[model samples]
Target: MELTLKGLHHVSAITAKAPENFKFYTEVLGLRLIKKTVNQDDISVYHLFYGDEKGNPGTELTFFEIPMAGHNQDGNNSISALSLRVPSDEALAYWDQRLTEHKVEHGTITELGGRQTLSFRDHEGQRFILVSDENDKGVAGGTPWAKSPVPAEYGIVGLGPAHLTVETAEDTAVVLEGLLGFRRKGTYPSTAAGQPDVIVFETGEGGSGTEVHLEERNNLPQEHLGRGGVHHVAFRVDNEEELKQWIERVRTVRLPNSGFVDRFYFRSLYFREPNGILFELATDGPGFATDEHIEHLGESLALPPFLESKRQQIEAHLKPLDTRP
Candidate 1:
């Protein structure tokens, strides 16, 4: 069965410390901490979900904040960085100075594809970029980055396409087009987003509004997976059965994968493209509210059904986020 895979679901990463990771993304970057939970297998560590107010699938950037994990070095065969787009070029200037005033080391604002872009690292060297564009609809946080030039009304539009540097272009292309069903869109002006010659692809109608990109950079160092690095890139599938079809298709290609792990909210199937970048296929169901009440989500430690017995011990091990901090 040729499953018509949907677009990107969410990107998950590993963080060194839960408290610090929470602070940087929520307090500094202004993303909402939507769910506070633990990994079912390893209850001692926290599985934090950050996103827009409701934790929509595409808007989320999940984390496994395993305490005491070492920092990871980023290179090719890894998701290099996540680019978030702002409302306009004017917003880029706003974030640039705001990052500087906060002592958040950021590269100078530079023009790419005729649009202004700024790059900065989180406390863990997780690089983030903000590009000013009119077409993006990325959700912004409830609170604005204090130095934000754009008002909360027009904060970040949405996740701009995530960029990845693969080991080889051809191998990666096969997986994108043949397995993932992504078509090679068209080349656009690098000045539009200040990017290198980016090769675009999409489920359909690719544009600033909705699309994902695979920018191949060869001769790069291999990416190490640990603290402050992307753990996996997930794509959306219709449901569990559809996901199963994908699982079988991937196996037919002789790809190594971790089949169907129950992630509490969604079911996940993970595998690597030929270039060795990890990809996840997840169902869009039983979301954040599956356990906790929507109104009071992310307030306490949540456990999956199988691990509910360990809730108390998990709570005891977690270092309280002191959300007010």
Candidate 2:
């Protein structure tokens, strides 16, 4: 069967402090706390998800909390930065002032790939760029949560282009093109001195939400993962059958992968491209609404069926988390 990746599913990153992370993402950023769950593999720790109104597929930005994690040491072969989509070019001005009022470290508004953007780092140095969806045409953005601190017009709508830094750009390019079916979109000048222009790639319904910007730097060392570093980036598959087909496609290409992981909200397959950057293909449905009603998402700890049996033990290990929203 012919297949095309729908768009970005979600981007998972690491956070050492779950409580503080929650406050920043929810109160400060105006994103909705859609899920309060534990990392499936490490039930003692948290896996928090933030997004627009209902935590739709492309809108999710998740974080796995590791209390003792070290600071991230950035370099090549890493998901260097992530972009969040805002409604228009003018919104950049609003965010610039909002971020300043909150004392969040950020850059002045600038242009990248013909779109206005504002770069910033969270308390833990998690890098992000707010990309304006001013004239964007594909993969429509999500609806901002009605109760967000920021007004709907200025709230973040969804995930945008993820930036990847690699040493051998061609190796990663091959996987993006041949294996993942992404096409070269264009290029933009690199912010770093003496570095080559970053290459852009996109998949289905090409737009900010469906793109990846690849930056190649040969002189840098590999990144050492820790707090504030991205764990993986996932692309969207339409359903379980399609996810299974994608699983087979990954295996057929001889890439070692996590076969079929049923994440409850979505089913997925995990793999790594040649540069050791983790990638995942996830489905869009059997979504967060599967276990909890949309109205009460993130209000309490949510356990998948398999973990329900250990709820007592799991709750005992986790610190008190107030996900009031």
Candidate 3:
């Protein structure tokens, strides 16, 4: 069976403080707070979703706000950084000034694979990059939030290349190529000794959100999940059938998987790759607008049917979030 992931569905992470996380992404970064809900498994914690106006798949970056979680220890078997795409060099310059004015720590523009990138870190020390792509095909793929402080033309064009740290690229490379239909685009040498070469891979049409760069760090320690750590990175599939096909594919290869789990808005199948980074394959259907009206998204606490009975209890426990634009 042949399969090609459309792009990233969403990148979910843990945040130590809810207010700080909300301020950075929505206020500073100018993303829309699309969904306000609770974690399905853990009702005490908040599950917040930020994205473009419509809360599209590739544009989403969700978080589990765990106020007491410790800082993450960076190492192998983890996603190192999340990248977002911008329209042009002018847009990059606009972001450079915006981040500076906000006193967000960021680096000057640098070229990576012929694309200009601005590296930065969030308040919680999560690494990120804003890469410029003049000919971005996904520009019209998402709707920009009308109330974003940043101008519409300079708004984020969804996720870009993500950096993954692995112990060895060989086994992960095999799964990426053999199962996920990713092709090696290029490679670069590591800057330090004992570090393995960096391998770049791409799926779909190969631009912006479709790229995944793998860095090998054999001598590094394994990562532990906490605040600022990636919980899981999800890839998009067209519908339920395609989702099922992937589950079969993973099982055929004898990979341990969480078979068909309904995530309310979308169905999901999860499996840890050979390198130990958790990956989720999710469907792009019945999105964030299913329960709430489009205009009122993220305005109130939305709950799935199973959790509706406990809405009163859950609401009492969650910190009141200010999600205004």
Candidate 4:
């Protein structure tokens, strides 16, 4: 079967403080906490998923908590910034004012890649840009959370172009195009003085949700991955059968990758491009609602059946997180 990746599935970042991360994303940013669970690979830390009302495939922005992680030392060859899609240019104005009222650090609204954008940082200095969907036309954005503190119009709707900063653009570009099926879109000027223009790439339906912006900066140091650093970016695959086909494609290219692995809510395949940026291909279904009622999601600790027998031990290790509304 022909293999094609849909678009941005999710972007996982690291955080040192889970409680602060929860308050910032859910209360200040107005995203719905769709799942409160532990990292399957390490069971001791929390893996928090934040997104729209239902936590749709393209909307999820997750974090893996590491209480002792150091502050991020930003540099090259990393997923530098993450983008969150808001409704319109008018919504950017609303967010600018809202962020100020909450004492959060953010920048004035400006244009990037032919779209209005606002740059900001989370508590841990996790960089982000809010892109306006005013005239966007590809991979539709997800539904906003009805209970979000911010008006639905101004609430974050979905993920957008993940900004990648690397040492050699062509190396990463080749992997994106040759290996991942992304097509070159266009270029935009870089904010850094005397640097080359940033190249844009898109996959699947092609819009803010399906784009990646790559920038080459040979002078920057290798990034020190820690709290506030993005862990990886995931692309959407239709199902397990399609994912199996993608695994073969990656293997054919001779890239080391994790064969089929189940995450309960979805199945996934992991690999790293030549530039050392981790990439994942994830299935879209049996979603978060599989183990909990739609309305009760994120309100309590949720364990997959594989971990259900060990819930007592797991809960003991977790810090109490009361997500009650």
Candidate 5:
């Protein structure tokens, strides 16, 4: 069967503080809070989602807020950075000024794969890049949030190339190429000395959100999953039938995957790549508006049918979060 993974569906991370995470992504970064939900697997933790106005698949960046969690270690076998697409070089400059005015720590603009990028870390030290794609190949476009502090023209487009740090790229390359339909695009010099070259992989089409860069760090220590670290990076699949095909493909390749799991908003199949980073293949249907009306999204806590019985108990344990922009 052919693989139809288009681009990123969402990049989910862990945050140690709920209030700070809520403010940083919604206010500082200017993304809309699309869903206020709890982690179905662990109801005590809050699973908050932020994205474009309509909660489009590629625009999403979610979080599992757990105040007790510790800091994450920087090492191999992890997603080190997430790149967000912007419209042009002007947008990059706008972000530089905006971040500085807000007292956010960010680096000056730099070039990566011929594109201008501004690197910054969130309050919890999760790295991110604001990249300009004037050609519009990588990030098609999306609806801007009506209440965002950043203007629509310069707002974030969507999730772009995400950096995956691994000890060796050989086995992971096979999964990306053979099973996931990603092709080897090109190579770039590693940022760290003595590290293996960084390999670029393109899925569907060779554009911004469709690229994934793998950096092989052979001598680095294994990383522990905790706060400020990526929990999983989900790739976009069109619907249920396409999602089913992927499950069968995973079985044929003998990769251990969590067979179809319905996440009320979308269905998902979770698995780990050879290098140990959790990867998810999620469908793009019944999106954030399935339960609540479009105008009222993220205003209240939402729960799937199975968790309805425990809503009261869950709500009691989870702290109240004010998601105002």
Candidate 6:
């Protein structure tokens, strides 16, 4: 049986500090901090959830903020970058200056996909790209970030699709198109976004939202897994049974994948494409509120039942932040 992934879900990253990460994504980037908690397995570290108002599934960009996490080199076995789409060039310029004024290090605006983009790094060194798409899907349903300079109408819709840079485009294509159920969306000329060949896919709609891109960097540097490096790219599946189908299919192709991980809100299985970039098959069930109420999200330290015993130690280690926007 084939596992038809619904679409690209949330992207998780590794961060070094909670306060700095919160400040950049929520304050500078204007995303909402939806959940505040610690990693269930290792309670010493904090797992942060940032996204649109309700912390919707796809718009969320979660992180594990480990103190002084070392940096990784850019090579194979890592995700090079993740791109978030905005509504227009005005948004790009707004982000460019806003980030600069906050003393955030960033690069110049470049033209890509027929739009201007502003590139910058968060405190953890993860590089982010903001592109202005004229016909992009507007932000997911939710209240606006109170401090967001960008109006609620033009807030971040979701992942403009993520970039997986690989050594050989040939091997990566087979899995992207064949196993993952992604169709060839289109090609684009080189843009300021820094990739040569841009091939896009849509498990849902091909509009300016819910898409993923495969960037072929034939002889470029490989990415190291460290601070700022993406941990994994998760594809949305309907439920646990769907996730199981994916596990079986991936194994049929002789690919190695981990068993289903109960992530509280969703179940997941992880596998890598030919180029060693990590990919996850996650269910879109029992969402964020499976554990707490939507209005109370991120208001307190939430621990999974198993990790409740260690909450005291976990709370002591993490530096508290004024999570209020």
lDDT of 4 at 117: 98
| Colliding pairs, model 2 | none
Deviation (Å) of 72 in candidate 5: 0.8
What TM-score would candidate 6 get against the native?
0.88
| Residues 141-255 of candidate 5: C-alpha lDDT, one tens digit per residue | 5677888888989999788898999988888898898889898889888878977778989886568787889998878899887887889899989899999999998998898
Per-residue lDDT over 1-325 for candidate 6, one digit per residue giving the tens place of the 0 to 100 score: 5556666678889988788788778767778777888876577788998777676667778898767778857665456677776766776777777778998889989876555777877876787787677655533323455556567656775666677677677688898888877778787764435657677666755544456666776556767577788988887788888788788888888898887788776788888888887888888877777677877677678777667787788878878866753
For model 1, state the Cα shift of residue 294 in Å: 2.2
lDDT of each: 0.71, 0.94, 0.86, 0.95, 0.88, 0.73
- In candidate 2, what are the lDDT values of residues 1-325, reduced to their tens digit? 7889988999999999999999999989999999999999999999999999999999999999999999999988999999999999889899999999999999999989889999999999999999999989889999999999999999999999999999989999999999889999999999889998999999999999999999999789999999989999999999999888888888999999999998888998999999999999999988888898899999999999989999999999999998884
Q: What is candidate 5's CA lDDT for residue 283? A: 93
lDDT of 1 by residue, 270-313 (tens): 88887788888888777888887766667777778888787677
TM, every model: 0.85, 0.99, 0.95, 0.99, 0.97, 0.88
Clashing pairs in 4: none
Superposed Cα deviation of residue 291, candidate 1 (Å): 1.8
Q: lDDT of candidate 1 vs native?
A: 0.71
Q: Any idea what lDDT model 2 has?
A: 0.94
Model 4, C-alpha of 231: deviation from truth (Å):
0.4
Output the worst ten-in-a-row residue range by lDDT, candidate 6.
135-144
